[model samples]
Target: MKKIGLIVNPIAGMGGSVGLKGTDGGIYKKALKLGAKTVTPKRTKELLSYIKNRNEINLVVAPGKMGEAYVREFNIAFKLIGQVPEETSAEDTRRIIGEMLNGGIELLVFVGGDGTARDVYDAVGSKIPVVAVPSGVKVFSSVFAVSARAAAEIVDAFIEGTNLTEEEVLDIDENAFRDNRLASKLYGYLMVPNVKKLLQAGKEASSMGKSSVDSKGEIARYIVENMDKETLCLLGPGTTLKAITDDMGLPKTLLGVDAVYNNRLVGKDLNEKGILRLLKKYKSKKIIVTPIGGNGFIFGRGSKQFTPEVIRLVGRGNIIIVGAYGKVSKLDCLRVDTGDFEIDKLLSGHIKVIVGKKEEMVMEVRC
Candidate 1:
């Protein structure tokens, strides 16, 4: 029997509201602001149905939302190697990868977005062949399947000895993201190696990322409306945040994050440490960021401008998230990660990032 590893990023699409763009990490709050819904059980059910009768494949799955519950729903017995923590992060995904690698699964199937792909890349890299389900906002990479049912087709083909190809994995600019900048670095390619009868690995797929242009415009209007005195608004990348700068009719970096104060660019792509220097003048501050679709990472991958010190200086409560509906529903819920373990903890536990006035959103994080 061929071994396969399955993982589902449960909250992968929760950032599709308020124009934050992606919901992987920093933008889930925007999803809440825009009234987005989760795409969970339905997507899960689809996968379960396809794999229900397969016998040539041995399924090794991560527990709960990862695959266990869905497997049971389809009555497909699977080996449970690990359980996702009640508040699981991409860390859990990596842990599962370790297990899959140790067990030497032939193929890895991931469910989520670009951020999720990055996580998978970090864990498995080019060691094995992988195919992803396009369940996130912006799937900029080339390792994904065409559609939900299409994923099943790939699996079937792989089992039948189809050949897959190598794909390029992108390294995202997290620091620029907090300031509303978008610069993607091409890390390299991992060859999945075409199999004779296995399902053919797909090419780059479409993205659910909303145009941040209008959202940034709206945010700029809000900043202008509220920027009477000394409040500083730190901006992050993506079209949404760029909208704010655009509304001001100023050129903003689409790939890097920036800060807006008094209707002006204060800083650009400031990391956690960089924000420390800028924080000296601004007592009242606001940090803006887009969410990563699927992976739900708030800080590690994108929005590196809002560093731990910056978050502390600005206060997590003062952070504002932005996104549109298309970005949020990519994942069933929302997610966050700052890269720093202790900071992840400090930022965890019912943190309230500003989504809007009286129109705020909340997330339950495990730091």
Candidate 2:
């Protein structure tokens, strides 16, 4: 049997919607206390659902929520690799990867974000190529495939003898990130089955220079001038959208969803349920979101608070996308992986994104 290693970070993205930034260290407990749910199992199952040649491979997985729980739900049989603790850690990821490599697993598949990528690199280096499923709050690494289905495609190509190439393993300190500071570093690289548009580029930090700031100012001016007084505006996180509130002289959360009405900040740092509650109170609503710098993700990266139900309530036409020219130009296309196929479809296609003052461009939205 063709042996493949599968590992899942059970609490990878739990901190995102809860506005905790990441589940690294004891923050996972805080995320749980905030009612954050497991994200990787669902993503893992989505990746598994895309595999048509499952019978051709034997998966080696970690125990419990790490890997076995989702794998067990499927018909495919897998080998259990390690003993998992009730509370898993980065060391568990490192240890499980070592076990997977020692067992002669050909391809390594992990469901996680940047921190998980760092663990995989630390464990095995470039010994085996990896296919990463994007499932964390900080998916700023190039090692991951663009989406769950794309990861399955990469793995299938690997089994078919496709050539592997190096992809960057990038990560940031979660503690630093939660403090409103970005400190990204290149940990190493991972070999991956490379296919065009299948892999994502490493997250690029937005330019803090005058030119980028000027462009954001222009875009912010345009949005504020076009705002309707009767509409309740839900603003997603990022420096770009924060610029809007900055120009309006309103308080804005730099990393969490906030609400505005009548040119004033109404709600701050809202969760999914909090957003839903506002939607119920307001009859006219709109969602203003900006794309992640390098990934071009308008949803499913940091702003999981804009859940599918929230998007549906806001309606597709009511959603506004904004991006700086420097940021949007680096991306191949905009992406949205809302974890709901129907909702993704609702968001897919050409989207008009505001780039500057009275400047908009139509960009393709890929799922």
Model 2 clashes, total count: 0
Indicate the TM-score of model 1.
0.52
Structural similarity to truth (TM-score) of each candidate:
0.52, 0.96
Off by over 4 Å in 1: 26-35, 51-53, 174-180, 193-367
Which regions of candidate 2 deviate over 4 angstroms? none
Weakest ten-residue segment in model 2 by summed lDDT: 173-182
lDDT of 2: 0.88
Model 2 per-residue lDDT at 179: 74
Write one digit per residue (lDDT tens) for candidate 2, span 138-253.
88888888889999998888877788899999869887777766788989989998785798877778898999999999999999999998899999988999999999999888
lDDT of 1 by residue, 216-276 (tens): 3555576556654477777766666666677777676675556777767777645444466
Clash number for candidate 1: 76
